[model samples]
Target: MTSPASTSSKKSSPLESSHRRVPTACTRCRKRRTKCSGTNPCRNCIQNASECIFQVEDIRKVTVLESFITSLKRRITELEEKVGKKQKGENGTQMPSQANPTEIKDGVRAPDTKQDAKCDDTRGLAKRDSTKFDIHLEASTSEAVYSAIFAIFSQSPSDPPSPVRSCSTDESLYNDVLLLVPSPGLAQLFASVTFHRFSDYVNNVFQFLNCGYLSLEPLALINQVASFCEFEGKWRYFAPDAFMAKCCMIVALGELYEPAYCVSPRNVRLEPPLVDKVPPGFAYFKQAVALLPAFIIEEDELGTQSVLVVEALTLAAIYLRVINKNIASSNFSLQALQMTINMNLHVAPLETSQEDRRLFWAAYSLNRTISLRVGQPLLLSAEEIATPMPSVNQAPSQKQELYKSEIHPCYIQLAIISEDICKTIYRRKCTTQANGVSSLPRFTLSMLNILSKLVRWADALPQNLKLDACLTSQGSYESHTELDRNRRFIYSLHANYCHCIFITTVPLLINLVQEQKQKGSKGSLDNPNVWKIIHMNFEACSISLRLYESLYRGKLITTYGFMDHDYLFSIGLGFIMGQLFDFSAYPVDISKYEFLKSLGKVFNILTNLLHNGNRIAHYKCMQLLDLIRLNPDIERESTKMAPVMVPAAVPVAIPPPVTVPIPHPNDFFLPFDDLLFAEPTVGMINDFYSTMSVDYYNLTEDDFVLFSDTFDMHV
Candidate 1:
């Protein structure tokens, strides 16, 4: 049975032979289904192929188009090489050590594996080196190759890692080997991959890419594939915006193949399997293409928005693949992503109603902008997408408007994903890391730091310099406010990235717990139940972290969630919580988790505070119960929970025992007073509420009842 990826590739049927695409149409299609006449097929079948029994539409024109694009690229590379050669000859002076471009790029091994001999001529490209380049940092498209790589570099704060030492590779080589080399980078990236280094074969092919010492036919075809599939991105006819989208897709895929991690830092790798996990001490390619538009001087406003579409499509493609069940599914998704890459959506090339068009652009822009990273471009109906952007600055004109609905939800979603990815990796690294003895995977502190910074790029969105205000038509700007939680998030992320590089545990766990508690304050973070959200985020974070750790450090001990809560227990949450309360007075989840296997440390901490005796801290813990009760908003509304920027001196005493009425037993009390706060056991603590004796206006104990007895519990 064909694997999904292979099936998708095979399912790509031959296109009907238009006079133009004859060279590519299969002989069977050319001969009208009954089968081909001979060699290439004849005019009868060629013309009648449409009339043939085979389905006219079964063919996936998109893949064929992709093939066309790849062809063109190969052609271009040839031209570039020829041009370079001529330039070299024109100089007439022999230079001793001019490096081949492919040779200069290290980590890329020379392909030595045996590929089908016919694959070379049929594909118009050979698989010499077999190593792939991760064109991350732009919209990445994984087309016309063995596999693609996506690389993301971020700066983290949780685990500040040490500085990275760059691993340089050879530059001046290009060969047909690229065709067969397939996902060479994955060797450095610890993950399940089909591509193993072809080694000896990678050597000579790269020279072919440097100068047109080879044929141009393959290159021409490659370019067409890129254009139609919106993969390679050339011909410049698909509109600049479409091209940009394609570029973005390329970068996204590059990042994907960047590399994966071990489940832990200490687990032994699967012997030979380790060989493909990455070259020794490999360094990430520093230059990026996504920043290209920003690099352009004097970029126009509309163009900037257009470019974002590309970013959306590109980022979407890469992220989607990470979670996708089938790698080949990306090819289909790629076409959908490519559609919006065109600027025609904005320009309204077709004849349509003004209102309709306006509304369409509005919604499209919104969905695309948010999706720019995730790649699942909103399948908004053209009508909704066309919704006029909220009056480009609150204009009086008859422009339709959309509410400010997209950002908050989108941000939340993104934050959630980023957080989860972070935790997944963290747990992974801890468990898989070698005892400073095992061979490490390729991805190291440097890459994790880069990933942190990339995620923080979200925070950079609101920075004063340039906001992607596609939605803000016309709003007067107020003086920028001081740092918000978003800013704090980015800062914290920076610290986490750094910590990861250095591989320190205590600080990492401490920060996540502390920071999340801060987020859980009044309502904002707590509204959504910040603790739960943190759990989910860390889950994802741990997965991604583990994936990378294995590649850079060692394999994980287990594939499930990366780290056991025992790590949490062993590190001693009580010690961390104590420090957090001391320094910030915030509340974290001291609550027991069902998923957590062991409950040793938490009980110990609770007992320690009780035994060792810190009254003030104990009072605060009791106070936290009261605080939780006072602000039922703790769970109802997330906004209220943002860490208090500054301590506001409110009346600390619980309203001097004031109370009015208690309709339901769930009714809240006037003020909180310490109740029977015995050892925290399985039963719910009644001390959550306070008792206060106020004047006549305030009620008595008979008037008040416990809210918990009747009120529903917060999830």
Candidate 2:
């Protein structure tokens, strides 16, 4: 039995244990004022799914002091060894045997042991001194060979450090280093004048674009702009080049879409030549481009500044697309996508803020659109993306209106389906059969499945954004301003929906054309699925034409807009293919009168585009019209109508038709062949068709490559 006093002395006092504090707390627990276990990855941090960071100043100071003491000890040992060696040499006698090689042991000198030697060897291996051979190469001959090889590549000690460092340090001294950025006063003026117009454009014209592609909230952006204009010193808080670039982009987009800058169909013929007249926002856009190098190249870390850079790039891409610079727009979008991936924004764990997720999705959407348009593979695929779609409900009340929450998630779903179509249908594959047929059955099934999803997606849209609601209630919105905005939103959505339908069915149309060419029309038309596909494709083309006509009447479609022209061109080609192949032989729902009217509408739209300084549109219109006039069946139909289809509201006189000389098979003037391929073979034709099988909204000049065998088919 132990005594009571001895037992009390052995146990710690309760008061003493309660008063004791941990050495340090994790950042999360410190913020929350909660108890911490003082361990790496504290229990509270683990429970909260947060990172455990210990940034205690005392611990860092103590570590620095210990390093200082160890360094001092090393220096003292080296001096002592020198002194002992000098004494032994002067006295001509060996030092005492008890004096062993010294090593650092807890801030004191001790005898060097085998363990310390092993640690020293490990440190030496890690250092990997380039002047000497590697430790593993212990053989004398290997050392000699290594020394010989290293001598060839190594710089001489007499030589100064690289001149590259001089260039980097004095980069600002170069005359060209000074970009033509706007003065602060001029920049503020530009921002103030254009920002409201840009806001109005976003709210009215392109409402469907309210997805968080802008990254920052409108209020936040407005505040930043205000601060930038009022406080010249705000650059200290933000990256000057990146922030200014973003401001310039916002102003550029605003100027691009300003109502005063908007050209209606009636005014298109009155405008000057495209090359002679500067673009609406060219000045500001040029400034942004000049500043972009600083923004993109200087930043090495991922943060809010990097996110702003992505937004600027995205805005630049949109501006480029609007001005018909499709290739440049795609390149910008790809860069933004690559930046997002580099920042780990595509992964969920690194998505530290809602802005990051929004920026990631925006990059993804833009990249997917451009890649699909250009017939390029996606840099980041749907399967590889770990970030979640933006949620409207998760957004704050003030920002709820800024996000088209319901529409964006649905848009993401549609984008995924579009990706599936690209991967499954348009992906290049080798033909195994002797007939050069590759998985027609698999292709047909894939088309049907994708078409079903598209149909369901459109049907599931909110009532306000539904295609039927917008189409049926078109003229009813004349009284209500809110209803008109909804109408515009619905129009954009319907156009995308029609584009998806058209893209999904095009490959089937090509397959049907091929089958008919080989087995005759009757055998191909025997399948009921072929009839369904033909009717769906026809409806898609017709609906798209009508949508464009409505947008044209509203003055919402810009002549300089590449997407509008691309849509018209693609639909025109689809109609031409239908007429050339005589698809009316099948029991399709569309009548001959409706088909001719839609085709006539497309022809008129393209003709109007020709007068608007759209050089590509002129080429496209001529190619399409020539295809019609050259075909015997369509020529008869076209000749029976007026020389040119003109809308009644537009009083502009039609220009005289400039006859384009027909090119010989071997001539360099073959537009279609020159635009894409050198030779016109069936394989080249198939490749062109495959390119057209995806989205056409971002078609560049090179994408105008059509069937080069037009003469052969007509003959």
Candidate 3:
């Protein structure tokens, strides 16, 4: 090797020697493929007596590229970690480290044990509590924060929940943590006090569940109307109608307000006040009604329908119903509906600022309910109305947040479902009859379609709105109250949905069975063709009874007028009738005693409600109870008669058997025959309903069928 290297060196040019190399010889060394040690001043530089430096730009570019690659690697690692965490959650097997990564030990993050994770959660809550007062400070500094809490409390039923993204951390505290701390300052105290007072005022004057059916905030504005007695003579003279309308509503609502059930005694009776000068509630209501048309004309002359005008009309209608002027109420309902339509509320644009949707839905609900009661066709349909479901989260200022007491989306869903029901079921009934065409086929199909739709509707409800949710939550007055309201609303929907099933199936089932029987086929409740209907009815009745019992004992008094009452009465009657029917007459799936027990509970609840000042309920319950009492116990009578039967040898002449007309299974009379056939006829059952100003026709089978599904039908 030495010999070859010596020969190569002797052959090489002098310029190739490292000692004679230029300052840039690193390139030459590289180009010539000779090695140069990487040092600040290498052999080539030393040979040239010059300091060596590499090209800066090339080194800088390589350095930058390396840094970018490193950053990309770091980001990929973070993404992988996140995906792993998500996978763990999906698998339901959380890693100890991921459970509470905030936990640390010995200057290093530690994996949280089960006990440690719980402790960490407790600490987090403690931290929130420690900063409760700081929220006021934040509120004072940030108007957005203050408005968020106000927005939560101010939410009208139609408005979506306030969005929490704006101040999630602080606003979330408003719900989960009870803010019982006395205000640290006047600003805090005033805000809290004002909100609580306003909330109470809204609750007292209006029903939350009815928000979708009606927005009465305009009535709140009306409350500001100066009393005629307090106004100066000239002012009173100018605004007499306004003052009178306001007085009428105030007095009417006063008369209608019953004391809370807990405080009201079983037999407490309130007499209308006999003031020397002030008009009675009814007189005031009448005067307001008489003046409404002219007042509306004046408003129209001035320009358009002011919210106050609409409000007056709505109040008059509502009070008309309370005062037993249903025809007048229906008229007012129509007027309000027309006014809302004229206002273009049902076609609310995406940019619509105020929540007129509540007003529209309220009027629509009222109209739909009245239409059902009167057997009239629905005037509104979802196809014609473009109003979207009210927003679920309101953005007050920039930050959006949800209240702990957020309104349930189920209410909106129910509203839509109800509209569908009206369109599919009631509309078809009214239209087919009006057209004077053969309707059994169409009617039967509509009923079946509605039944399936209702079942699907029920199945599609969110988990949080299910019956089980109604049974949970036990602590905290505020939480309990919110949950109670939510539970009641959910149960109301459940009751309504079930009632629809009973209505849709009963007639169809009966008709099917009867038609089949006419063709020489036997029909019974146990028959496969009819069992679904019977079983469904039994289940619906059972659920309704359970809800009735659960709601009767709680602070949640249902405020939806007549809906719950009608449902309870109908369900009770059906169950009791099923129990009373001679067992040998037909095959029944439910136990008699079980139905009897449910009937007892229903009667007790109605009695309690009657004492709580529900005259309609009182009349219904009394009639049902009286009829039940007067009827002979068929089960007992049959058992006793069986043993006393005469032998064939000593048989006496027997008259031809007396035939009594038994109602078709689908007939409403099937459940309440006692009321019609008892000894001395114990007064007409229809007469009892008349005592409360309800017409006998309003309780007919058609009415029940139509109204039962008013809140849920799919077109």
Candidate 4:
């Protein structure tokens, strides 16, 4: 109060004080276009008896110059640090102490103002890190655009709610659903059959094919089955539906492998023929499917029981596939995948149990297999997968250790590469170019990469698991049980490997065929890339055909399933197409005899399957036979070729030939009968052969028609 000038300078102006006090406006006041008291509950809001809300201002307008300056400052600091480090290294001395030490603020180290000022000296020489700068700019631009759009469309309290109804149901409905569990006597019999015949095979061999079995503990599953068999009255338990479903699915799968269910003329005669009787496992599978809905509805409350539901669905899918119900199998596999994802199994945390990891990979492997087989899009991509491969060291037994250490990891890796193949080569965008010509160079590169991985996968196999080792040492096992397990495992592994090679190289074969057709000659194999493709396809077809022969002689072929049949058919078709188009134009001299013999063996296998009640096999066999008939010279050449040598170690026990009564020509075999036996018109055959060069997977049904019509027309 000594002087008026001093007092004026010390006190703030009225406008400045008012600006500080009114930092933001209340929503109620802003909506009315009136002045805000700035407090949370403003005077107007209090007077009107309405709640007041103040939204935080998150969007800050950044000028180009301001952003540039900030980037320049950051660049300068980075440059100074780099220079300091380099100078210290050159001088063989430590860096000088910073006058202003760094301090930690909000868990980030912040340099003092003095240290920042020192960085400004070399600002002109400092270069911007374009990679980081671009990323920052992109992030900022996206955020600003998003903020503006969000502000424009922000919801208000007065807005009405969405009209869509909830899907939630009463909890009582889930509990009230009837479960058709098997009686104790039947359950005991089925469980015994499963445990004795199927369970051991699954634990030792089949689990490698589809890893979902790894999630199940054999002893625990046994205990659960026993408990269920004894329990009475509605089967009350935690997640009872899922538990019963799992139990039923296990028994259903077991039924497929039982001796009575094995597809032979004897078995078919003892039971109803394929056309009349439902598949062996249908009763239990029906029960499993019925219980699945209740478990799915109450998935949230099930907790760890959710894994059992996935396992049940997976087993159901496998059983369905075994019976050749592919569409339904695909649906079940996809549902399991969806459930796995919902449970966060795909991105399993580090602390997740081994069982969970195994379950995740099983779902992943099965989905990938189905997608590749059906030409469907993948439900999950590799980028989204975080679960690690099942660990070998974690295996409780030496047998499990062998599989986990040697087979499981390799299989998972192959599945991943398979996914890559689907994405790179089969995806619609990658398959075609703007001008409509196939992208040959791009596809060729992808094929090479995938083949290299497949080669590595083969190379990484343990000594015992290798194809050559398993084949040569067939008599080396101590017992028939071990021999059976090893035979199935090695055969499956080798088959998958050959199939991958075929898939990788087949596109090139198609291209070569198309080019030869267009040019009207076996166009030059002078190109190394073309020759490489031919060699690969030749090797794959030869190995797979030979494997089929081995399986046939050993009586190890799955006569009922579509898998072996499909594999044999595809490889046979490849062989025929190669012979017809002269795929081995350059290398025909070396493999011609072997190739002819393999082709001849296919006929024998197909004939055997036909007698075993496999209609698909019958259809495939007839098609190949027709192709041979059309080309008599090829058959003459095959007849002259030496028969393939059957390994003496594997006893070729030819079962007593049972006469299979022929069904009426008009009789159908469920879904495939109509598709397989449909008469092909001239127009259909022309259209098929024209587009055959464009797609491979889509050609099976049409190819059947083409072959049948060609045979009929010729006869």
Which 10 consecutive residues of model 1 have the lowest summed lDDT?
Answer: 142-151
TM-score, per-candidate, Cα-based: 0.21, 0.59, 0.49, 0.58
C-alpha lDDT values of all predictions: 0.27, 0.52, 0.43, 0.52
> Candidate 2, 188: how far from true, in Å?
10
The per-residue C-alpha lDDT of model 1 at residue 665 equals: 9
For 1-715, candidate 3 gives per-residue lDDT tens digits of 5697669767877766654444443553566555555555666567678656655445443436634754674565466568667978798676544433322111112122443333333332222211000011111111121232222222231121222212222223223211222213222212222323333433443432333444554334434432322333112222445544544454445444322432111232333112122212344455555556776666455244355566667766665454334455667878888877877888988776445766676677666554443333456676788876555544333111111112333444554565555455433421223443223234444554555566556556555545544344332232123334445556666776666665554443323322332343333333232344455556677666665544544444432243555567667655644554334535543563366545655655554454444444543453344334333452233234333421112111322112211111111112212122111111321222122121211234554344332211111
By TM-score, highest first, what's the ranking? 2, 4, 3, 1
Which parts of model 2 have CA positions greater than 4 angstroms off? 1-216, 230-240, 261-273, 349-352, 394-403, 431-438, 471-483, 514-524, 643-715
Which pairs, if any, clash in model 4?
A: none
Estimate the Cα RMSD of every predicted model relative to the unseen true structure.
32.1, 24.7, 30.5, 24.0
TM-score for model 2?
A: 0.59
Question: Over the stretch 1-715, how does candidate 2's per-residue lDDT look in tens digits?
Answer: 9998558645857664443348688787888897677778886678778899988675443436645875786677667667777888899765542254333332112223443333234332233211111111111111111122222222331122222211121222222322333335334435445444445543432432434234546556765555544333222223346776776676666655554433333444533235334555566677777677776786664356787788889888877766555557778999998899988888877446666777888788777765665544578888998888776544536533434455566667777877887776556232223443222234455566677677666656666455544555553332112234444445555666667777667644543443444343454244444455566677677666656655555556555563566677668767866765655566654463255555666655565555555544554554454445444556566545544432112111323223332221111111111112111233432332332343422323332122111100100
TM-score pick, better of 1 and 3: 3
Cα-based lDDT at residue 628, candidate 4: 47
* Per-residue accuracy of model 1 over 544-642 as CA lDDT, tens digit each: 222222221212112211112112222222232222322233355533321111112222222222222221112222222222323323312212322
Which pairs of residues collide in model 2? none
What's the C-alpha lDDT at position 525 in model 2?
Answer: 43
